[model samples]
Target chain A: MEEGTASKRAAGRFCSICTQRKPALRRPKTLEQICRECFYAVFEEEIHNVIIKNHLFKAGERIAVGASGGKDSTVLAYVLSELNRRHGYGLDLFLLSVDEGITGYRDDSLETVKRNEIQYGLPLKIVSYMDLYGWTMDEIVKVIGLKNNCTFCGVFRRQALDRGAAFLKADKLVTGHNADDIAETVLLNILRGDIARLSRCAYIMTGEDGPIPRCKPFKYTYEKEIDKYAYFKKLDYFSTECIYSPNAYRGFAREFIKDLERIRPQAILDIIRSGENFRISTTTRMPEQGICERCGYISSQKLCKACVLLEGLNRGLPKLGISRIKAGNDGSGRPDEEPTRRGREVERPILESKPCGTLDF
Target chain B: MHLTLEFGGGLDLLCQSVKIHQVDVAPKDENAKLTMRDLLAWVRSSLIKERPEMFMKGDTVRPGVLVLVNDCDWELCGGIDMELEEKDVVVFISTLHGG
Candidate 1:
């Protein structure tokens, strides 16, 4: 090792875990200073352990990774492929991306996903908003403005990913939602009193009862580690704020999480643990899940949020799906009934204060 | 001293969207050696063009920003107090962006 001076060289610290090479990073989960090689070993092995312990995958299964060309998903795609090959998991992996049709933001990131498809040699399926919803985010933003555009994007993107997975005929779907993302969702859900999502947000795997089972292998992985891994490995991923995302509310919660992480990195995992342990009261009325009457997508309401929002957009009353109107106004107040044009002028407050994004449950 | 500074994970946005830079930085005092704390001040004044808060807070990097000196985590080198040498490579990456 090159030494500026003998004294400074003496102060060099070796890897705490390997006790050999210089430590490259301090893992947030274990707070252990590890070398680059050991970091990769432990990081991958921890994910493999999480997979095996949770039984997230089965032999000869086709799994689609919900890739956004972001750091977390990029690393997830790389690691999953590596593990499948290394351990003989006998799984077929596919990269699934949703094109929101935002001009400068998503368009740029999708290029990275395209590159990942070639780099990882995984088949890619991109489902676009224009094809599915008949409107792109750019078009929606033009009509709806920035105030509640995220609601439209969030609702649409969730269904788009599911539809893409169905088209791919993959047995399971996985997302790159990390510990920090889940912890943020937990906080947002609690703040909004969204018991349904708050109870399930901490789950590593979800949608078992739905058409496609979705899992989060990085449920406990810290975002910091993912970022560092991508940096050290020179992983090619895109990082830019969405053009349409003001996300002021979620930004506050995200900032709070970062602040707490600074104080105690363990707080991120603890918040998720607290969320997982919360038990809902039996007496509380839960929203019943049923197929949407119009679109046949899964929904708690008679019509899915997508159909409701689409109907409003088509009817030139984009707020119809989002506004809180009294129940049973138009016989069943379903999408089939034409919403009254008179009450369209009245603005109601958004009930769910949860931040709208791809990770929304 | 000449050093290489690389930014990634959206940290490049603060630096006119340039990801890498080769620059010359020296200690504030002529008789003393440079430390990470001094280099941070130099980077903030010289390189960061916008949203300084996104890069730093309270004399160190903002939470969720990872720093590496000579390709090794600065945490292993006493964080902001680590002594810097000529031709060292310093990398900063932000993990606060959406996945």
Candidate 2:
């Protein structure tokens, strides 16, 4: 104890783990009386191995991270930046956040992402639904109604990210979707009988010619572990649900998977591994994919869906615009061919007013 | 039984409800004709007929239209290359912005 105290006179910094100014204080987390330097080395070693094992960071690649200011993305940016710097992965890291202009939720999260940009020393870009369509998510919800808010956000944001990535010329885009998200998506696909999605959703999505390669470095990491890691590391992240994302279906799927995880901790991993092992039948007469006639985005036959919807909004036919709800099968036991049930007529004038955007197929 | 039908959401009134072969599922898989191709065809033809000006450039769907086959996105599956199976539900939602 006397020798330890003597050492305190020589060193001037505090221990980060213990948060003690006493130089002699031993940081139990680091398992040594080490300072921040030693702490970072030990912490980064584990992350380094994870990256290498997964081949996440490629040499001389411009990496664009889809940062939502959430725990998953923030941690992703932190770890990737650290690894890039410490291990010399030679990655030019940039942070990209697609702001769907969702009231309260996304606005607050974007503020956190701004802070993270400065803290992590990564360049950031924010694309908003308002900028692209001249209408906010809240505004769209009122016009299109809450029934399809998820559709607008998800679709618009997806195109926004892809377009943003292309503008930045990023070779890769890294999303923060972890194991829990992957597992939930798998079940959602199965329930919906989406064999195509079920077959292609892998943890490591390679960059295709037209579409940017999207990678999930934390693919193997669980949501709980990400939460714990963020807590332990004192990471600042936005923790809120998207205001318009009352996606009961996804929530149900998430709960179903979580319940299974209670019995088998590796359920998430198993689902992901299963996704890897599964093969899709490619012999079907697949829909023809073509560049969007307007934005030049890859679509099934020219004119990507985003451009079509954006054109609708631009033409002031907001009501006539398609929504995300229309993207999911409600399983309400009613077929699309069924007549509009009682009181469903209220949704018509809105669709009819838009001369250019009405669905007349 | 072949029935003339129209779809809801963005896939509203079909053009004359063209006659097509219908497959019956045991009350469970009857609504399985939805696919990215169907939605794209609907959007392309509808946009052409309704918004002829929008289609002045050509007969193609503009970007931001979301066609989901069961909660899974059509874009993810070969981007409209996805096949529709029997009893599969299709949802053609527009990704419009208006608050």
Candidate 3:
């Protein structure tokens, strides 16, 4: 128990990458023991390589980072800015956040994002649900209750991010969706039989057809490495969960991925690869993309999910688009009602039931 | 043995929101040396006030929780069987939390 004895006893093996400094962590992807400096070097380098390999950005492109002030985005903002300068990527980086207006939860985290703006010296733009949909998550929860509020938030936040990026005139939006998150979505999409999402969930970049395409720079980075990098670098990021999302079904998938990772560290990337290689049948019925009749956002139905949900809330029937078609269809009887109902039945459970924290879009 | 215990990435919420603790923990067996396996049980019983499941699964820290001893990953030193020493700083961080 003496100081000398403790020093001798606790001196861990040297870094396999550097072989001089003590190893700080074991990389889950490569299973290599590396020191803090080597870990940082390899971690940042891998993400940079992913960016270059995927052609994620171009010179002078205005890129907006989907910053949630959490470990992933905080690290994303920091590293993206660092890499933009280090590699001379010639990208104009901005921090973009969607405020769901969950009062204490989001308000507190937004402070971290504000600090991040200063810490990383990036211009920050935040779009709130109240501004766009005239409803905060708290108000939506008050009307719709906990049963399906996440649906409204997820749909609204997705659009909110796009609108915010568009307002910033950003050509591309980058998110902090790591390998674990992508893997969880792959599993969830497979479990729910959402073929369209399952097919594209593993892609490093998505929504190429949309106005502002989104990319996942950390698509292959492990969450464990991000957390350790933030901790060792003393980066500021929020850590609290959204108070309303206590029992999200995505928790099951997240836990399953973590368990798989415990047995085989390669499982995370393997699941993503499996999702990528899956080919949907040509005969399969795919949702056709069109503009929403109410708003110009892309949608498969006449009205987008957000417009339908907002109409329900505005009409004082918050459950209008949520519940299944029963005998008692409230007599509003709009002409486009049938397709919206069918769309809700197909998409709501899979997308809305996801944890709000992990809504990458 | 005297040691420092630090929790972050929302794991501290389970332990009354105290991020750091300095305490003395002795091996249950007089003849055997203390290891991380023993320290985890000690922390679970003494520090974790609620939601023990969030902090542990089976006899080890939960799958997404990273363990570091003296600034080095416990994985480098044999994981749960890694021996502990006086004044060693052990940190547990949960990566399963939001973002």
Name model 1 segments beyond 4 Å from true.
A1-10, A326-360
Give the top-scoring candidate (DockQ).
Answer: 3
Error of 3 at A32 (Å): 1.0
lDDT, model 2, position A162? 73
Looking at model 1 chain A, which ten-residue stretch has the lowest summed lDDT? A348-357
Candidate 3 per-residue lDDT over residues A1-361, each given as its tens digit: 4546534644645778878876777899889877899999999999999999999999999999999999999999999999999999999999999999898899999999999999999999998876676667887787677888777877778888888888899999999999999999999999989888886889988888778888999999999999999999999999987888876788899999999998999999999999999999899998887766545567776666776676676556778667853222232433334322323222222222221111233
Candidate 2 C-alpha lDDT tens digits along A83-140? 8887899999999998887778788889999999999999999877665555577766
lDDT of 3 at A273: 95
> Which residue window of length 10 is worst by lDDT in model 3 chain A?
A350-359
Q: DockQ, in order, for the candidates?
A: 0.62, 0.01, 0.67
Off by over 4 Å in 2: A1-47, A315-361, B1-99
List where candidate 3 sits over 4 angstroms from the true fold. A1-12, A326-361
Better of 1 and 2 by lDDT: 1
- Give the true-structure RMSD of model 1: 5.5
TM-score of 2: 0.60
Name the lDDT value of residue A10 in candidate 2. 32
